[model samples]
Target: MNKQNVTVNDLVQAATKFRDDRDWRQFHNPKDLAISLSLEASELLENFQWKDSAKSMEENEENIYEELADVLIYSLMLSDVLDVDLNEIVLNKLEKNARKYPVEKARGTEKKYTEL
Candidate 1:
């Protein structure tokens, strides 16, 4: 599949197929998967640790991309294993957020919804 056209289902299928080929499903329970997801997120954040934003973005783009892929792979795996439809959930949350952060209140501010 073309990378630019890949869907969430494609990623989930590929990731799970890799796990299944290696007989790793036995070790992919929710707790461990969640831990791995958090670890990947931390690794993604590490690319910017103590670095100026522009310098970090310029110098660590490759590392950032790799870590982002790791994070998305794990998240896609988790959603698959849990039988959660990622697209539906994201859209649902967007609806909820729209109500909370109406554009009139959130357009320019970085404040939380409650503070807005």
Candidate 2:
């Protein structure tokens, strides 16, 4: 499959197939999946630890992307197991954030909505 053409659903299907093919669903309870997701996120963060942004980006680009893909794949697996629509959930959260942080107040500001 072309990486550029892969979508969220495609990833979810691939993850599901991988799990099923290995009879791994028996071990993929929500809690375990969530833990894996968090662990991958920490790995992604570890790539940047003690390094400046430019250095991290330049020196560990491949590792960074690999960790990010791991995080996203685990997240998609969790979402599939939970029967959640990832894109819908993200869009809904974005809409809620837009209400909380209107462009006029949020633009060029780092403060929280209440602080603004």
Candidate 3:
């Protein structure tokens, strides 16, 4: 399949199939999935720990890719288990963030929306 043509549903189906093939769904409850997602994210962060962003990417690019894929896979699995629409939720969040971080007040600033 073309990478560019892949959708969220495609990812979820692939992840579920892989899980089902391994009989891993029995352990993929929402809580465990959430924990796995966090663990994967922490592993991804480990690639950058004590290293500049450029240096980390240069030295750990392959590991970063794998760790990030793990994080995304767990996120997809969690969303599937919860029956949540990932695309819709992400879009809704983007809209909410746009409101919170309007250009007029948020432009060129690192401040939180509440502080803006």
Please report the candidate that would top TM-score against the real structure.
3
* lDDT (Cα, tens digit) per residue for candidate 1, span 1-116: 67898887888899999889999989998889999999999999999999988888999999999999999988988998899998999999999999999999899899999998
> After superposing candidate 2, which stretches have Cα over 4 Å from the reference?
none
Lowest lDDT 10-mer window, candidate 2? 1-10
**Clash pairs detected, candidate 2:** none
- Show the colliding residue pairs in model 1: none
Candidate 2 displacement at residue 113 in angstroms: 1.6
lDDT of 2 at 70: 91
Give all TM-scores, in the order shown: 0.94, 0.93, 0.95
Across residues 38-73, which tens digit of lDDT does each residue of candidate 2 receive?
999999999899999899999999999999989988
Better of 2 and 3 by TM-score: 3
The candidate scoring highest on lDDT is 3
Q: Which regions of candidate 3 are displaced past 4 Å?
A: none
lDDT measured at residue 81 in model 2 versus the true structure, 0 to 100: 87
